[model samples]
Target: MARKKRPEGTRRPNGASSIYYSEKDGKWHGWVTVGVRDDGKPDRRHVKRKREAEVIDAVRGLEQQRDSGKVRKPGRAWTVEKWLRHWVENIAAPSVRETTMVGYRSSVYKHLIPGIGAHRLDKLQPEHLETLYARLQKPREQGGKALKAATVHLAHRTANVAFNEAVRRRRMVENPARVAKAPRVEQEDIIPFTREEARGLIDKAAEIRNGARYVVALSVGLRRGEALGLKWSDYAVKWRHGCPKGSTCRSRDASKCDLREGRGTLTIRRAIQQRTWQHGCDPDGSCGHRLGAYCPHRRDGGVVESEVKSRAGRRVIGLPHPVIESLETHRSHQEIDRERAANLWADEGWIFTNRLGRPVHPTEDHRAWKALLRLADVRDARLHDARHTAATFLLELKVPLPAVMELMGWSNAAIAKRYMHTNEEFVTAIAAEIGGHLWAEEDDTDDDDGPATVRLAI
Candidate 1:
């Protein structure tokens, strides 16, 4: 059938090239030429509406945007799902550590995509994100998982970042996620062990094979990964027997020193992590398997040696006498175990390891910590709380805040402030000091004729 053409001399109302009506399709159509591609083809968009008035209004909006120089040329339509996958694969993967990349992938795939990926990238509104958050707070029985505020916040942040990238790429005029309200994440109270409780825990840890690991955590405030990643060679011990007072000794004797007098410094360089390999197969196609359950190699995921969490996280901490002593003892115990195992020993050179000398897995480390807490009869706390315990102790002892921050390897002063809380004893001592200046003993009065008038000093 021949196409139905518009009547001859049919002119658009405003004489705009973008206004038209399709007689064949019985719908109003508006076309705007946004730009020309390098190949000399016009980059155009066709906006269709059942009503001619709506199509005109849409065309005028695009014309105004073009006049204002804010018009974004239409490209292939992008949904939230497509943009997120692209961003995670291209933008976020290269910059973040392997562990952090895992978190990004998890947040994108598990939560953000499922929640809002159906929306068009340019058409997403703040209300859509608001609805998603509201749904996330509901119970699983009601079609929501009731995720924690932190997890929800993670999803919000992931979307916000991805949308920002979209805007940068000119895919959207603005990021709606910036205006969306996510649930506020409340800070949990820091529960640090008391001095006595810390001692008790350390003593119990001493009975275990990996006691020095706990000592490192409690004494120097190293994070769990930092302590676990420690190598024996990272420890630098200064021996008293090696040198007379202020004299450099060239002696190379190994057995001349008393273990009780050794002091050392431990450098934190790297942290151990087990995460899924971001690059699953060889890019050259040598291996055809994707990284997952069925992959013959790396089935359990990959082990990564990553830099410390922050630049400040890399530090050299001086060990106290007791901690140094404990490490020496722990070293001797490791030697004995190595001799017993002989050819069975793995010899990974890690300070804390399994019976066969393999590095202790993080999960196994947590189990050991729990068992030690039970044995010590102390209230349970996360392994991270040991770092808090150290910080609290330093602050209570009147260590300067700057010194404490440096010792704890904290880049932000606010983090130190948040973690170091004043206990009742410290507050009571402060009160006593204030009271000493504000109050004076009443003069001894012998007269019992009424209660002796207390003198008030202005």
Candidate 2:
């Protein structure tokens, strides 16, 4: 069948403007005026294809993008892999959280680099990116897995971010990813523990070592890393002396005989993360370990306390009376553990630790949480669900959304609405606030060594 002829032009002079059959290259061609040159002549982009229909479609697409402010001038060269690596290491790394960087690295190295790395950066187009997304959803036997749409969307986002940086750096003029379609991410429902289940977990936690950790998690919506990163220094105690008739009394009246009463405030400044260790020794040396962890001179990485990613992550939370008492008990046991380990203890000052006083590995922490669930006769749940459970309790308590946001350390309200995640979790940046008074101190503690318990100076 003879191909249909495209019209000579379909837009104003400044729009897509023109298209024609080209005898010189036996192809159809189009030109869109993109900008004015220094001398005032129109600076135009040339688009060409063998088929008239293809040129028309390309012209219209560019025209639409141009009008919408997402268009870019035809670009110039680097391999997609080379530029992505540079963007991840030099451009994007310093500004992102460690966990975020880890995700970017996974997407870049484990997928993008290998998939489209060989393609020229300037020549990469939306179709290429679209193909990569489709390929990513293929079965595992075909070099990809049946990944969740959200996982694929994350990869798409990584590409979008990387190319946006490329455009900013003037390394590329266009972001193909901006035009590509990523898989649709389906929102998953968050299954949080019910009030009874929370109580059951709490009852069982009492029988486990450092059970106060779970208490803090379920009571307040602290991210796993934030809870683990907590230190004795972060907790400040205030004297709340009250009556002897009740072992637990919240009454402010000081009329009755009493011992010292105290309330604890926990400040969140950093998070504990398991980082991949890097080799400190030369690769050519006698050490032959494939993984850096086995390298005797491994120097660059290990479990670390990283500052919380956002401002909301660094705030003070007022602990409940029960939680405060549980912590005191937990602290006393830690002291005993320290005495028993004597000289063998690492003394990192973590609020929760193993027998050697090292930070509890996240995996081990998950295992312990699972064991506690069995002891409590509760249904299965991820340790992170404890965060969701806390959000539920906060709502049930009728805490203000903003206060709950501050208490939970969520970055925004929309995240809080995700009910706190129809999958996991929410924050606010409350400034040094405590019961009607300024109640926090500037953080002067060293990131690695958390020591010296400062009194909660309320």
Candidate 3:
């Protein structure tokens, strides 16, 4: 039997419109709409049987609203630049290390701002992000060289994280970067220097014009900043004991007072970000004192501050035996120089200072490292490889991961694990032992059947 359709003009308890069903495209549809059209006239849409129940509920809810209604739909409209500024101000500024903040700022300013800063938040689709990623993979201008996949990935990751925060803050409903795909980038296999190679490089360093520069680099994995930041006081090799009044020089008496300088451990407490040489002036013209004009803060005879990299970068590293010895030797020679200068000498206590006792700049340290590498005939490697070398040697010695992490000043295992690559020979040997028994077969020619022996190698 065919069912009869309801006539128009029926009203619900909500009192706005009546429900009705219609057939179109061989399927039923339902909708309820009340609004003005572009012609300034009213418009209506029929509600289908399937959706009539939901429509009725929604209509009733809308009718009950007596307060102000939405003039426009809730949506995201902030630009990438605007959101990034907000993130730095609210999220990143207080949490991360200063050096990390600098890096984040640089990446945002140099790479991302120019790329997508102008795009509206809603307008920044996945395609725009993908295009920016592709451009980063292309050749750069200076060297006509493209960035490594890892570097490109880092940039992408930074941007992606920023946009994700935007989404969480309701600045945007979606993260386009989440949908953008980048190329698979694998971490490079580190080529750790063998004992022989390390010795050879050190030997070659002795032959170079600036041999001490390489000596410092090889001895302590001092990120060029730490090395350049070296001061005489940074190495606390002497300890003064509080002595009782009656203590003799040779006595270890518990009751006697004794304070003496002895062997002490070095603490990497602070680093000098900028240095300048100031000369002492004798009021008399007969003994004139002049300070060097070259200074880190100087900009065309003007002084500028704010050059320090970050607080996290100011960390402590225990001096190894080799570092202690090298520093001691360098200090003994410096004492001789100081004695010779007498009244004319500068009192700057920098260990790696120039003749005027001014600290080396980070750029100069890099130049010195390159020169030393060239003299030693070593292949190109980043200044950071020294740190990798340190961690690698520690792992090779089978040091516990936790201990290594502490020495590296990393509080998290995940950060330390980035340096933890398995030893190839150790892996191969372990794998062979585990699989050896699985492939073992019993001898068929034995006179009597016997239980097979399986050996497990530790």
Candidate 4:
């Protein structure tokens, strides 16, 4: 007969687990029912230690974790790589925009997975994350170059978000990435035009194809994607009920207007971007194609319309008179192009379109921007600089910060500050006004007989 087991040590109360001295293992043991499994069985957490006190403490720790609902599910061991892939494809894909999802996927595959993906999600520690970031900063010796601080910061952010979700999903007791330090990201310099340059560029824009597009860029501060994705239906032109100078009113609103005269509004409804496709065969993407575009079973991808970056970005902007004039002229020109294209015209109702009435491709638009700057003899600047110029001009005009934010569709004041810059012209004008008001219209001479000098109280 099997030897009788020694009576289990004094029974502990519910939730405290039972403690016993196991003769075979020569160790103190405790078993706590942390939760119930799906099959209606107790999910028992067993703790074994050489000392009875240690076993009791471990059991107490388990009890606390259970009470706090911070315990990882039993038998579910997730690796960092596994969880990240799951998040990007399942958890994050459905909710986030495609472009944002792309960044998440890039960080997951390019940085996080290659670095610390093998670690169990529940076992990850702050030090492990720190080590990965440090390694990412190390100079590339054999082949790969060190990642920039910004790139590493992006990785850290991705990991932080991913781990946060894992915790929410009950895969991890806590987020290790939150305790890890992120790399500092430096601000990038932006080049925006002075008022004079902006006027000259607008004039020169008339000489190029789709010049009104650039006018909208500088005057309205619409992003390239926003402009390219514009539709004729999105314009809400407000026409004068009747003209005082013997001019007939075009129409009551944009939809009925003849584009001869009107100052209306443009609503940013969508943006165009190239989205990467995912393999349809297997969720793991193991069918030989690394990139989804290369896979034969790819479902959806390529240039597509997406929602604006944020709700704030989908704002309505009232057109300035010049912008309205330029757009009216643009519409007349577009009609001519339509007549020329005849049957070839697609008539997609896009505000800006090619000769065949198709939306202007981003690459072609980029080329147009470069040509416009070159022809204008202006300093070369990114198309985005036009937006910056708009912000700078708005700020210089003393427009309220909140109004500028609305015009620029900035989600935060910080972004507006980044895009807005004070050029020398503003300071010089201010100085001139101050000097002219305080002194005669003459430079001060070194002689003691200078005109009544304005003095300030100390």
Candidate 5:
């Protein structure tokens, strides 16, 4: 394609906004976009001034490189499989949970390596990604359908992470996945409940004896594992007791149960994971609720913790007064159940336990949630959206960002920002105050056109 040159003060069509100058006011320009419009397909465009080209021709040359797809430099030829193994081993394994490592390995090997393993690291481009992603979106005739948007987004992000590592290692110069146009996330109106709605939900939860899953999720915004993995010891009702329960319990206090003057905190330590066994069935497989005075399970006769669904799951969360009260009431009910069941009930020490005193699984929680939503006449929203609700509530309360970050255990402020949109009215008022003169009132003088001529900033 030939480069096109624009005159010094010419405006292009609205669609040509994608076609940017190689250098501002330069004689040549280049453009490359994804997706097809009636106007044009996504392709490179270069402008040249044959009538009066620049003497230096730097912009023209750069535009040529873009047109021919020759801007990126060549790098090592490692296969996706090789680099992915390195990514898991060197980068992701130590930092992330074992479960997360397993999932990442599975996705890379099963989906990515088999699909794009042979492509050279240097030759890969956004188009390659687009083609692979297109196939992933199609339904299979036999059974399985396309992946969900969230899953696809994860895969894309995983690819970007791997490529970023490659760049850092000098294995590749640029990340092909970084510039690729990912499938647009379908924006569903899955808003979190307002404060009143949340309050109503909490009240409803109080009626259900085994609904601490909802309570913890609402109060602390813990993930499912963090909530389910909780044990009786994690709770500190009457006295400073055992280690904080859940995946995120504080280890520092694990050795001793010290209660400070401030409101009590629930420590998240170990999570209950469902693991397959062979030799013999573990009596405490379910990691069920333990009465602090339970009999004949271990030498110490205390609550036990086991594996959780994933590693990112183990985390600690401190509860507020409402959560503590709800928990106390819930525990009282469970104690009654345990007294009736007696030895028949499992020796498990889960805080939020069933009639059998076993820890509740995620599936059970889902079913309960669905039923509760119907009962409460509330629309269905995912469990994670509850976290969004909590974040928004905190923002509205004028809580500092750092406090929110700490409460939510967010790695960065950027992600927290995404969960809550800024208050538009506040922003507008601030802007108006700063630039009041620009919008100052003046006498209206009608021009030939219908509206009066007003000073508008360029």
Candidate 6:
């Protein structure tokens, strides 16, 4: 067939838009001017379509995007990997907390990048994200490792946020990730120790060295990190018989005091965490030279203090009498250890520390907790469940919802309510309360006698 040609006097349309047949690949090519470069030259994007009609459609879409001021000028090529790294390092790291940044980096690098990082940032589609989520939900034996819905959700959030930034920077017309679907996370049932089980655990803990730690965890619902981060100064004791005249109340004499008749308060302000240091050591060898040293890294490898998990986590809890007594005994025992170590003792002031006077490792604490559970012959339960036990006990005692929320350091009542589980006994009691009046017998002898008389019709 003969190729159609334009007339010699005819002129091309103005405004930098064109569609022509590309003989090289037997395809039609479309180009549209998006903007000008620094050198004042036209910046154009070339899109190819197999058919001439398709090319026309592509050119029309490009024109619409450009006229609507949604078209972004093409710059350096950006892959999903590059954009994600840049976004996390430049945008997210500075704005979020270190712990949060750690999570973001893990989600971005480990999952997001490996799944779809090679794709062009501007060309990302909703189907790509959908496929990623579907694959993540499959089992490893099926050529896909199943991830928790929560983990997948985190990845979705990271990608969505990054793509949103791309849109804000005009790097792309829209964020495909915004339309992607993620699985919903279900709330896990709270498992707490029964009162008897809790007592057994406490008794077992008492036989151990750091037994007071468990007591505090159960009594006050302090997180493990918060309990480990506690200092002697955070404790305030009100003596039963008031301090004798002007006698200075020293922490060393805590065990000697009659704690059974005293009340105590613990102020939770911080938590202890073992975070990986990006910058390990300074040029000088001055790091970790002394106890409680201000080193970026630990000398003997110890934890560093960090802010509480949330604003609500910072709270003042009134300690139970048993817990107060346990703490007093613990302090006395700690003083004995210090005296034995003499000059070797490191006074880091952490309430729960190793013999070297450094904070206890969470793993070691876990081991001790497990041993205590075994010794007490109690059912297996996570250390965190102690907090749930405390909350459940408070709710069972008819403590007001708001009071329970404050005591548990929860920001909302809904969370506190989740910890309040109704067992069979409690359910039965509630049922009785609802139906008690309905089951009551009524007096009817006098009414029966009066009913024997007949009445005349009016």
lDDT scores in order: 0.80, 0.80, 0.59, 0.84, 0.64, 0.80
Backbone-clash count (model 3)? 7
**Residue pair clashes in candidate 3:** 30-48, 31-47, 241-259, 243-257, 243-258, 244-257, 244-258
- By lDDT, who's the top model here? 4
TM-score of every candidate: 0.76, 0.73, 0.58, 0.81, 0.58, 0.71
- Report the number of clashing residue pairs per model: 0, 7, 7, 0, 29, 0
Clashing pairs in 2: 189-422, 190-422, 240-261, 409-427, 410-426, 410-427, 418-421
lDDT of 6 by residue, 49-156 (tens): 898888888888888988888886478768889989999999998877676786898889888999999998878899999899888887967476699999998989
Which is the winner by TM-score between candidate 1 and candidate 5?
A: 1
Residue-level lDDT of model 5, residues 16-78, one tens digit each, is: 423333455554443433224345654433335523334225445544454554443332367
At residue 290, candidate 5 shows an lDDT of 47
Pairwise lDDT winner, candidates 4 and 6: 4
lDDT of 2 at 266: 96
User: Which prediction has the highest TM-score against the true structure?
Assistant: 4
> Against the true structure, candidate 6 has what lDDT?
0.80
Better candidate number, 3 or 6, judged by lDDT: 6
lDDT of 1 at 65: 66
Residue range with the least summed lDDT across 10 consecutive positions in model 6: 449-458
Residue pairs with clashing backbones, model 1: none
| Candidate achieving higher lDDT, 4 or 5 | 4
Least lDDT summed over 10 consecutive residues: which range in candidate 1? 277-286
